[model samples]
Target: MEAFERARLNAYFARLAAQFTTPERPAAFLITHLLPERPAFVRAVATQTDLRAVLPKPKSIHAAARREVERVTQCDPLSRDLFENDETALDYIEARAADTPLVLLDVGGYFAPVLDALCDRFSGRILGVVEDTENGHKRYADCDKLPCPVVSVARSPLKDPEDFLVGQSVVFSTEALMRGRGDIMHGRPALVIGFGKLGSSIARLLHAKGVQVTVHDIDPVRRTQALAQGFTVARDREAALTGAGLVLCATGAVSLRGDDFPHLRNGAYIATVTSSEDELDLGGLPDVYTRTPDGDHVTRYQTTGHYFYLLNGGNAVNFLHGASVGPFIYLVQAEILAGVRMLARGDLGSGMHDVGADDRAFIAATWLNYFNR
Candidate 1:
């Protein structure tokens, strides 16, 4: 079997290459989590054009995926073309001049600093950047101006289905995590922080699994929505945290912190669904509690009568199982690929935009055709 042979299993990639990629496209830069699908996406992009490099998300980049990507892109074993983090990728890309536009495809806004630099310093055409996560979009949202238009699939309707499935994956992985530890999470009191798109789905899945689920969101509207859906919303956060046997952080922005650590129920198991360690602030944990390592990916934080288990440290727990999003990841990946095509037109100007309706239709139709066939 060849490197991209795995990629060919999903017809979507070849189709994506046909529709969005062309030989004339500018050099592509990819900022992504190197899951099993990454090499597949890379192979697809490489099919019709060339890539400048592939930069893996610093923490979550899998070793196997890296090797496969190196193989798929045919990078010399010692080549500097593959990068492991933002800082390194930036160092390489910032040296270019504005002679030609650079195409960016990023996840979690990993290349925000590069984009910001392009706005003024680099003087190159950042043809555009395609952002895949909501928090990633937020990183670019604050800037009043940009060097090039950014097309975001993070907020598009195309992403809604994936959001629901991501919640399912997170809960399913949480359940799997427990089962691996010779335990089950059913009937346990679970507290889910954040009730937005992903949070709401995680809460509901936990509830359906027979776990007594409580939800907390900073937004009053979200809290009310949880209540309307028959989930518990405690009068205060401390109370909710103190009762949960399983605490899951869904809000990509604010999930947990060291100060909130003491509030967790004794013997509780906690996890998060964010891409990075930002979801749960771990720097505060040691100051508040004595820690004990509980084998792989498990840390026990406790003092006196208080104790809780933090799973996978503080990163997305589902990823521990590999290809965590399964085939459904294609939905978001496909939209992101389309964003690359749109930016090539050089018409969106210097602002953030969504994948247009026509593009969405093509993606949806292609997706249905792939599945139905």
Candidate 2:
């Protein structure tokens, strides 16, 4: 990391430590999908209050991250296995919260079950939950009421940094994949579904690379935005899928499935820039005609005469191919850390909320200064 970037991170964490240490520090439970900045964030949280327990997503914990988590939780006796599923995760949270009021520091909405469990068990004892993904925000959106406030860093302006990073990684990975397969993207038509932050970024990158990009989004506003950016907006799903050389899914909702198979051009590649579940209906697809693992990061799926390529098994391709979000992830992590403090301090209402504008401005300005300097 650059000197200014590191300084900004430390400064932000120090501010969080100051805000959360006074009055009375609440026990914090961190459930995260491990990322480059997570260990540092965990260490920072520990400096302000008790980090009660950690539950990391399965396959997310690495040697370094596990070591950091162990270092932080060595004092806590209730630490358990890395949870593989929601049921087990809920059990762990319920067991741990039997004695203490807890704050949830979450990524990928992994602690959503904890929030549900708290509603029936701990009730008012929950400090709050800080969520870091749009998928997570949607997961809890339908809930009539939440036991505590939810501060969503995913909905904040800090997401611009994440979008830029994601776009770069996606473009890098996609180009490498095409080149390795003896193909080129220039002059090829590509369809990008979902014009949200990540999707929009991916579409822009594709356009810049000389690919003829057509975007299909359910949201009228997003379609308008894509049109303004000089990309064709597809009016029909089948028309978008037909004859496209590359089809990228960016909607954090299911948009592609087996039913759409007939519309796909033969040899067309399907990949996702967002969550796998959000874009592809894998279960709805026919049995794989052939499966070949391209090392451990990619898989090729064939059905009948057509083949669909999945980058990183339809998960965030950027993470698998180009490292997770690159160094810019620290900026998003900083916003999350700020949300953690906001949740701990209280006064926000129950329901999903964006990171405060002041906090968002601080993070953005810090990053801009680092880049400009």
Candidate 2 lDDT by residue in tens digits, 227-344: 9999999988898899698888877778788678667887777777666755688775546457677544556677677775666777766655534665466667667667766766
Model 2 regions lying over 4 Å from their true place: 1-12, 19-22, 59-61, 74-90, 286-288, 294-296, 322-327, 362-372
* lDDT of candidates 1 onward, in order: 0.76, 0.71
Question: Where's the lowest-lDDT run of ten residues in candidate 1?
Answer: 74-83
Model 1 bad stretches (over 4 Å): 1-11, 74-90, 95-99
lDDT of 1 by residue, 303-337 (tens): 88888888877778877776365556777888877
Give the per-residue Cα lDDT of candidate 1 at 330. 74
**Which TM-score value belongs to model 1?**
0.88
**Cα distance off (Å), candidate 2, residue 319:** 1.1
Q: Model 1: clashing residue pairs?
A: none
Worst 10 residues of 2 by lDDT: 75-84
